[model samples]
Target: MELINQTRASLIDYVCAQIATFFPDGADTKAAITRNFAEAMGRVEKCFGAIRPWPAGKFNYLQSAQYCLFLYYLANTIWRNDDDSGTATRLFLLNKTLNGIDLFYEIQMPDIFVLGHSSGIVLAKATYGNYLVLHQHCTVGRNYEVAPVLGEGVVMYPGSSVIGRCRVGDHSVISIGTQVVNRDTPGNCTIYQGDGGELAVRPAGRNLIEEIFRV
Candidate 1:
């Protein structure tokens, strides 16, 4: 994998600089960044490599979506393995400020996932599966202290939401602007709103997950 416009050392500096802009105590996180950056980047490489055609084997700092995932990996890695809550918090805040996304470090996102347009996306600490695709303004939130469990190859389109104790099966597509609130959908289907504004499911005509990822 190639890191564009940023060498490993430069990327570390860039992240530290970005954190400093929002948090004056950024200097304390340099060690954690140096310690966890390589592992986090390896995760990024694996994710990017799984994507089709574009954004594969390349980590471009200028690309907001790629950078957003990178920050998430870094923050999550630090939080999971190190005793540096402050560092992880700074990274999470920096990512939110830069990407307009609210993915907390504690959220256990899948390893093979992609983000489209990234902004205004809020993911709660839910059960996510591999090859997950999330578009802008898409949300996976909790309702009444219960979150949804999404299976493999689930795609949440722009403005779509899944809240509460829902089981979104494998290869299911949550259609744009559709909200699945405390509902369930079987695998290999598309969940859309019917003419009467009710949730409807139908067999998916195509494998959208395959189109986006090299499954």
Candidate 2:
């Protein structure tokens, strides 16, 4: 997927402009903002490569929501390290308002944590894997102080959750409404809700990432 395009360039410029509003009239501040914007743009582009033609239009609801979520992550990263406290605070508030997800947790942006929508998702401070695709209403949170360590190519369907100190292996699927707590799952498996609301784990029927994404 082409990451650098006219639309993406415009989107970057738009976000930079919004960020600049919080900075004061000084050359040093301007330079810092420029550097931060470049870094954020690079990370966001790298992570969102599978979803090409980003910064979608208003009508493209799903893509647009994803775009907003990406912006939130980028802003959160910048807010963490930037010296301008006021700018950081403004961006943090903006991110929370747009995505409605808790920003108190840490997110490793190198791995593409693909969010299907901006609503009904809560992510805690967990070790997320590469190509993590999370549908709406999914939650990956902590149990007490420990969080799940997810492997590559993990997909959590709508209403599914993997909470507590669990280890979800690569290519594992958490089926819709399946809740996995404090369990270790093997690679290439699926966790689904069985009879009587009991959760069952089995080998995955397909490689969902291979079918959907180029990676």
Candidate 3:
């Protein structure tokens, strides 16, 4: 529902801007604008079916609507994540580059945090697990050559990476500037290898979302 609301607001913004030219008025054009908005949403629904990572014989529009919106917003949310700060709830925020498909109007991201974008980030795979977090310049490729199976509460910090046939266990952290290729991590572990050496992995800060979105 959180992601749904976020994406809904995004849809309003997108559609409003689109029709601003033709229906720029107080109440005179409100009805017409509303109609246009509905049509736009339907188009987005179609694109959602195409871009989603999984393939199905049919789609549940309502469920897909909820999911598609998250992907749409994540692709455009810059870099953001809802941090838990040692809490049991694991939430994710993200940007546009973390999708396995070329997003047109629909791009569904994993409901996890993606710290940085606009630095050549790309997700070309489909077998990712839940609670996966990512940073700038990371790439999850296609096929089992390097498919990542992230565990619960996995974090990928700045310049960190997990590429190709990697399965990280629960509560594992990939530290800054580290590149993991064809490897597996155990639960409750910190995988860091940077210029600063390996920093201790902690439950992410509380204001991580606001930090990423700068909202």
Which candidate number would show the highest TM-score if scored against the true structure? 1
**For model 2, how does the per-residue alpha-carbon lDDT over 2-37 read when each residue is reduced to its tens digit?**
343335455555555655654434223334345576
Off by over 4 Å in 2: 1-33, 52-62, 79-89, 103-105, 195-197
RMSD of 1: 1.3
- Residue-level lDDT of model 1, residues 1-215, one tens digit each, is 68897799998999888888788763678889999988999999998899995666888899888899999999999999995788988889999999999999989999999998888999999999999999999999999799999999999999999999999999999999999989999989999977776798999878888899998
TM-score of each: 0.96, 0.75, 0.44
Better of 1 and 3 by TM-score: 1
- Compared with the true structure, what per-residue lDDT tens digits does model 3 show for residues 46-154? 4333333423223332353333344344323322222212110100122122233233222234444333333445565445444455655666554454457776556
Q: Please report the TM-score between candidate 3 and the true structure.
A: 0.44
Q: Residue 94 in model 1: shift from native, Å?
A: 0.7
Q: Candidate 1 at residue 18, lDDT?
A: 80
By TM-score, the candidates rank as 1, 2, 3
Relative to the unseen true structure, what is the C-alpha lDDT of residue 198 in candidate 2, on a scale of 0 to 100?
A: 66
Candidate 1 C-alpha error for residue 156, in Å: 0.8
lDDT of 1 at 199: 92
